[model samples]
Target: MSQRLRLLSVLASSLLLSACVSSPKKPAPVEDRNPQPARTAAPASAPVPPAPTAPEPKPAPGAENAGKPGYYTVKPGDALIRIALDNGQSWRDVAKWNNLENPNRIEVGQVLRVVPPGVDAAAVAARPIASAPRAEARPLDAKPAAASASAASSAAVTAAKEPAVKDKDKDSAADDDTLAWGWPVANPVTAGFDEQRNKGLDFAGKPGDAVLAVADGRVVYAGSGLRGYGNLVIIKHNNTYLTAYAHNRAMLVEQDQVVRKGQRIAEMGSTESDTVKLHFEVRKLGKPVDPAKLLPAR
Candidate 1:
């Protein structure tokens, strides 16, 4: 029995050893290193800045005088007619604005009403009031003449002071002081001044025909601004007279140029007319007058 016990024990030990050997071995435990912090996303980018803005522009001085606010100070060369032409108004209209009895008179440094009087109260008030010329101081005691002759002479003078007599005298004066009459060209009159249609006289001529000034004058306007009167020249003979030569092929003089009577001022052409001709006009105080009355008889 004891032998049997020993053998059994040996067998049990053997089986135990075999089982332990057959079981799979487990890996050694890894060292517990600090766990990496969870990865965080980078911060978002900063916003971009806005662009800068530009500045506004200012207005210039001496701009167009469309709406006249202040008065126009008359400068050296400020004539009623010139002012009217520059301002696109008529001289008559300007005269009426100032209540001028005579349009011929204006003074330097004078403030003329460019805009209508109703436009601005300040401008109207700014106009310098003109005083009449001081009358010549007559002698308090004068030479006594014969009563009969003085009375008769006074009656005659009173009669001559009438409008009709004054007009006759003015006509005579104009005839006396006016330039010697001369024909501008030998061409016969093709058309005469017609108050209804023709503004002046037309003389048939060839291109490049010599055009003569009617009187001694200064060239006021030498341009093509007047429609239907292309390549024109305007001469101011005096304050009371002006002459125009239109449809000229070429102009020999310029503005403000002094010219003598019967001077060749232009070469005639049909700039705005149908045929080669010279268009001549005589203006007395801006009114169209018959050239035939002033020109030498043909």
Candidate 2:
């Protein structure tokens, strides 16, 4: 019975050891029930560039030479004051140039050398003004017959002193003296010259009409290289004058060709104009002048 009790105790100990060795492991607790999505580093943003701008244009050359005092020839009927204003100089400069005590003493065919401000005052003061020549008159005392003949002679002299009526008639046919003269086309002038705005004159004509030159010159340029002057023709008159014709349908004269006055140089067209017309410009020393002052009266 004692042996049976020992075996039973041993069996109980073995059972306890087996229970300790066969125990299961427990899982760790989760903060969230559902698993979160995997997070990636955000992509770096790119930098943007700025837009570009256009370049500015350069000023015209020799513009600084303008308004400088210089010498000018006095044509027929040119007043001293008028010449001074045309050259951008003052009337005082004209008086000082000619050494005139009175500004109204200027005569035709005179060469006046004008000086600008801050010039030599002593040189101007040294020059003497020219005076007009005087004529002697006949005596009044004489016989009655001689007096009657003298009175008749005086009437003739009085008539000669008066302005010639025939001169008034010829005044309308006077020649234009303005530089860079040119005819627009074989038609009436439709538009006159405007310096700042138009820069030229327009002649009224049908499409494909003949255009002529106003004076003898050589064609310097005969292409449309210049902007706003389509199918252009430029003629060099002298050293100081140039004439330009634009919007032509056909050019009869080529570059460097010598052309005479009233010669056909081009045909009128509407390439640059709404209506068919000739665009004519006369430039004197690179400056534009009124074409009406240069063209003959119709």
Candidate 3:
């Protein structure tokens, strides 16, 4: 029993010594001299939007004639009589054919039939007024405002300076006949063609002075129907050319009457003008050209 006690004491002593010698504390963490920074993702950039652009104006209604024969697209400032004259038809006939309750109440962009039924519109041998606004002229004799379209009308016409040719006008451009021209009056020109103001030549003359036909043509329009014209006359020389005599005291020739160049067509007077004068205009494809370009040199 004494020997067993000695061995047990020795084993206990060994365990006690082992317990007293604890494991060496871990070496202090070595200081890092160089450290790599942690990587981070960049926020996505916003996309830039494209710039907006302006939209083009839509075409007017009835801009297309709908391929209907004898149909005319009424433009701004179109007088029924003027439409009739342009198409070589009487205003009454046009009114009858269209069954217009009030001929003067036509609307802008309204399509009109200027030719009677059963008649070939192509054989009318006249150029329709350009689809653009009809060219306007200021009268020398009337007040500045008086030169505008008739007060009774709602829409007034203004000139289109340097207008581009329309498809309809272009179609007839190649077929228009070149013609001889003469002066409509023998008076000093008081005013000349101005695209912005005066659209034709103004001749200072006395009342009853003879207004001559500038070319041999049929009288397509001879009446006091147009505003600011005052007993005006429009002679259709050909499919492409026409001449206008405005502010006449008396129209000697009638509509549909054929007149020769240098023949007296009207007596010059202040009808819609301030002074006794003759306002002469030359239209090619319903576009006013400077009369000086067509008239003979004096």
Predicted structure with the largest lDDT when compared to the true one: 3
Better of 1 and 3 by TM-score: 3
**How would you encode candidate 3's per-residue C-alpha lDDT over 1-298 as one tens digit per residue?**
9999999999999988887787655778999899989889998999999998889966543456644667887767777777765665556567778778776677777777766677776775346745434534222122222222332121111112212222211111223445777899888999999866776899998876778888877776676666677778887776567788999876666666666778777777787678889998887645667999778789
**Model 2, global lDDT:** 0.56
User: Which number leads on TM-score?
Assistant: 3
Count clashes in each candidate, considering only residues at least 3 apart in sequence or on different chains. 0, 0, 3
Q: How close is candidate 1 to the true structure, as a TM-score?
A: 0.44
lDDT of 1 by residue, 222-280 (tens): 66644466677777665456677888777666665666667777777777788889988
Pairs of colliding residues, candidate 3: 141-273, 141-274, 142-274
lDDT of 2 by residue, 110-200 (tens): 5565544466533433221122111121111111111234434543553354322221111112223533344656588778776556767
Q: Which regions of candidate 3 fall more than 4 Å away from where they truly are?
A: 1-72, 75-77, 84-109, 113-178
Error of 2 at 276 (Å): 1.0
Runs in model 2 lying further than 4 Å from the true structure: 1-182
Ranking by TM-score: 3, 1, 2
* Candidate 3 C-alpha error for residue 67, in Å: 9.3
Q: How do the predictions measure up, each by TM-score? A: 0.44, 0.41, 0.54
